[model samples]
Target: MKKTLLALLFGSSLVLAACGDNASDEASDANNPQDAAESAAGTEIEPEKIVNQKCSSCHGGDLSGGMGPALKNIGSQLSEDEILSVIQNGKGAMPKNIIEGDEAEAVAEWLAEKK
Candidate 1:
């Protein structure tokens, strides 16, 4: 069940990223300031640091699996949007509505490259 959930989440992220990317060209100018700023910051936010500061308590440093599941290959498992959703809404055993807006998005972008 755990692996299944992870797979589902991963697939969702990929689908979401692809969908979002397809629409990016049309929404470039429509992006809010926060989106623009996050885009300016570039992709990937250093998972090690973000994990230590915001997620280690539950997810652990190696992200091999803990209160949360093994996350080492999450980059390959999930897409940017799915990652963002997890950060924003969390998942079973994980709290929701914690990280918000850009922080969530930045972490997502970072995590997407983890694999």
Candidate 2:
């Protein structure tokens, strides 16, 4: 029983460590900003920031999907690059040229593989 409990605790710790890493990654993604000029120059921007600045306006708070489609599981449905392109270029009622350069990339990353 002692060994079994130890193993369980160890496994739980590993899971927690992984979760922490993912959380950190998410936080890092959010804090990082997209350099519009840099993106135009070929550098990509972080995704979370883009969602906060540009997407929250229409996509509902926290990507709940208001004027736009819900993005909970978008990442599973579409590739990161595809989402980035669509946001950058815009489609239909989305209007073109809303998000520029790295901002587009950031928003795409946030939306990609959501859920």
Candidate 3:
């Protein structure tokens, strides 16, 4: 299920990128995962550091749950896209944009692998 969703998103992104003005650049980006990710977010980010610095305090030092919900198995409950949305938009008592841009994308992708 996770693979299927990731493949779908990846395929969709490639298609969208291909539809842009610079087809050569887009096509190359489609063939390069690192490039695609960087373009999608702006730059490469260290998610673990971000999580430790920003999320550990609220979610628990071990991420087992503290002021916020347990994130140990967050991917079982939310997809990367859904997690990104929550990170960007906030939920319940969570505030928006605790992290933004590439940092947020990196964190979402990492957390979505917990399952």
Q: Relative to the true structure, how large is the alpha-carbon lDDT of every model?
A: 0.68, 0.65, 0.81
lDDT of 1: 0.68
Judged by whole-model lDDT over C-alpha atoms, candidate 2 comes out at 0.65
What lDDT tens digits, residue by residue, belong to model 1 across residues 1-115? 9999999998776445322342554377356766667757776555456556666545667777765687777889899999888877768856664556666777788778889
Looking at model 3, residue 74 earns an lDDT score of: 98
Give the alpha carbon lDDT tens digit for every residue of 1-115 in model 3.
Answer: 9999999997776444323335676898999988998888756578987788677766887789876899999999999999999999988867787778777898999999999
Q: Is candidate 1 or candidate 3 better by TM-score?
A: 3
What's model 1's TM-score? 0.56
RMSD of 2: 14.3
Steric clash pairs (candidate 1): 64-70
In candidate 3, clashing pairs total 0
Q: In what order do the candidates fall by TM-score, top score first?
A: 3, 1, 2
TM-scores of the models, in the order given: 0.56, 0.53, 0.62
Off by over 4 Å in 2: 1-46
Best by the TM-score measure: 3
lDDT of 2 by residue, 1-115 (tens): 9999999997776445322343554566566655334434666465676566556656766667876776778898889998877776676556555667656666777777585
